[model samples]
Target: MKFALTLVSGLLFNSIAQAGVGTELVADGFERPVWVGAPDSVKGKIWVMEQAGTVWIVDLKTGKKAEEPFLKIVPKVERKGNEQGLLGLAFAPDFAESGRYYVNYNEKGGETQIVRFVTEDGKTTDPDSGETIFQYDQPYANHNGGWLDFGPDGLLYVATGDGGSANDPKNLSQDLGSPLGKLLRLDVTGKEGYKPAEGNAFAGVDGALPEIHAFGLRNPWRCSFDAETGDFWIGDVGQNAWEEINVVKGNKTGGLNFGWRLREGDIKTPGRKGKEIGGKIPENYHAPIYVYAHGSGGTQGLSVTGGYVYRGSAVPDLKGRYIFADYQNPRIWSLREKGGKSTDFQDHTKALQPDGGRISLISSFGEDASGELYITDLTGPVYKIVEK
Candidate 1:
């Protein structure tokens, strides 16, 4: 499916009300569902990734999950940490012919691995067919950024978190040599070793890894491209006080710093104290488009879950509005940006309530082939956003 980029004008907060938005239960009995996606070849089938190392296909028409998993590798995955497991999945844009898909997961030894697999049949994958693309040793377990996506340019984009620990102790986010804490774009179409995509900012720069597309990210738990505009959106998890949502124009390539340990969500964070040669904040950094505090007060949120901009016709009011949520608070919000700044925002949690009850631990948000939105809860069950 192809989408055209169009700028929306005259959009006001009062005109786009949240009352028309709601959630409908689609599937249940999932184990720590973290990511969800759909292949372009499949019309109504949605592929869901469970953190415990399994993938399931759900038929939207019947609202039933396939009894047999699409893929399973529990024995090879390590799920000891709250964030570890089979983290991400993305289907090749030419999946109809190639039958290829990619996954990012933590290996049994706590190392991160990106692998490509092929489906023997149309519906399922052979466990032995996985071909390792690359693997990296993770210094800590907590912030393994897990998101795989195919950009409109036909390249694979990978999100990696800073090597875990409080406040990025090793200052890895700013280190150009390390792959951790960076967004990478690779030409995965080749069968052998991967190559950095053309126009990468650090392609031939000295002391910089060629694969680094963008750096200085803490834990970009979830990120997606706007199907309509091709612009990139990222939800970078914060340290203690704030959560941020960042946007990179679709035309820009790389060398964009997101200000991780130096500045967390527009506030200059204190430098590492009581240590030898504490880290210095870089002068060049990109601030998030929008940010919210982490607290019990009104409009405060915890752990931003990056989501998609509604381009589906089902929700007319949501068109062009970016829908996202808080993993800790379970509240959903819609943000409208104009001229690279947020213009309107609304809390839609109450509108999404099916029984005056909130959906808890929203792990991820997904977009279907038709552009409709779906969300997965870590507790269990998947819900589709619909007209109330």
Candidate 2:
């Protein structure tokens, strides 16, 4: 049942610190916190999402979580499976003014729902205010890709996993008809229900889902946009042999295919080795910018957890470099992409280890209003990236 996690032992477990980079404890005591983010309109506070269906506000200065959750929908959420539950939250780009925000969760009926609501104050929302912007039934429980955010273009972007099960029995990643295993773009800006963003890759195309901007993603656990360049980044978890980091630079994000069940980190997946995509395979599939094989110690890791390009003033040395890590092997590292190549790779694991606690099982990474980065540990603590 815990197949994905049980295979985490393959990453190299080196604890070497690279110097100049570390992490400071921001808050602790969260229950399986899957996400943490700051609304640009809000200052010095962050919202944390617990997998059990509660989003709480935490004061950055005191590390104190509010006595009451900012939002709670536990009874309607289904967490029976290891990967199911309330998994993501994002404040609208204009949240400071409109009081509107969104949440992505698994409803009790086995559908992954993306809902919109309004909060008069920064702290809370009415349980009955939820308006479903989108909902889809998941074929299986495991790989429900649950990350969503507003891209630099101000449109909502969502990630969904292939209808789960080993080797993607349905082959949804390569299918144009199914929404699962794809990056979707939607316009939630109007007064009415949502619409596929005007330029989504498959909009108006025959047979393909209108919201699909890119296809062939297995399970993108975390993704972010670079603050300065607006480049899109993804940490797509691989099936058996590898974990990869993918990117679409300069905001040119439409119609790309991130080879998934067909290929895992540039290699044919063991289960899909002989299968072809009905045409030439390599020409259209976008390869990962960087990929680490599951191996003994060092940079090898299982379950890649993608992070942001450091843009915070607090870590000047890290500026412009992308920070990422592994959930199972638990190491931190950074690299720079220049001229379409990943350079300057450095391991920050030893340096990022919290003085009083450990950064085990990193569920997701966060970016605050100031562009500083934070990491959420499924075990509890949230740590902020900082200069050592």
What does candidate 1's lDDT look like per residue over 1-388, in tens digits? 0000112233234323477788898888899899888987787889888999999999998888888999999998998888889999999998998889999999997899999999867688887789998778889888999888899999999999987877888889888899998999999989776889888878899999888888989899889899989999998998776788888878364788888777777676645555442234566577788887776443566688889888889878789999988888777888887888876777787778666556888899998888889999898788999986
Q: Which TM-score value belongs to model 1?
A: 0.93
In model 2, the Cα lDDT at residue 356 comes to 68
> Evaluated with lDDT, which candidate comes out highest?
2
Alpha-carbon deviation at 318 in model 1, angstroms: 0.6
Lowest lDDT 10-mer window, candidate 2?
1-10
lDDT of 2 at 208: 92
lDDT of each: 0.82, 0.84
Off by over 4 Å in 1: 1-17, 271-284
Each prediction's RMSD over C-alphas, in Å, is 4.9, 3.8
Q: In candidate 1, which residue pairs clash?
A: none
Record all residue pairs in model 2 with backbone atoms less than 3 Å apart, i.e. clashing: 12-297, 13-297
lDDT of 2 by residue, 174-218 (tens): 888998999999999997579999989888889999999998888
- Backbone clash numbers for all candidates listed: 0, 2
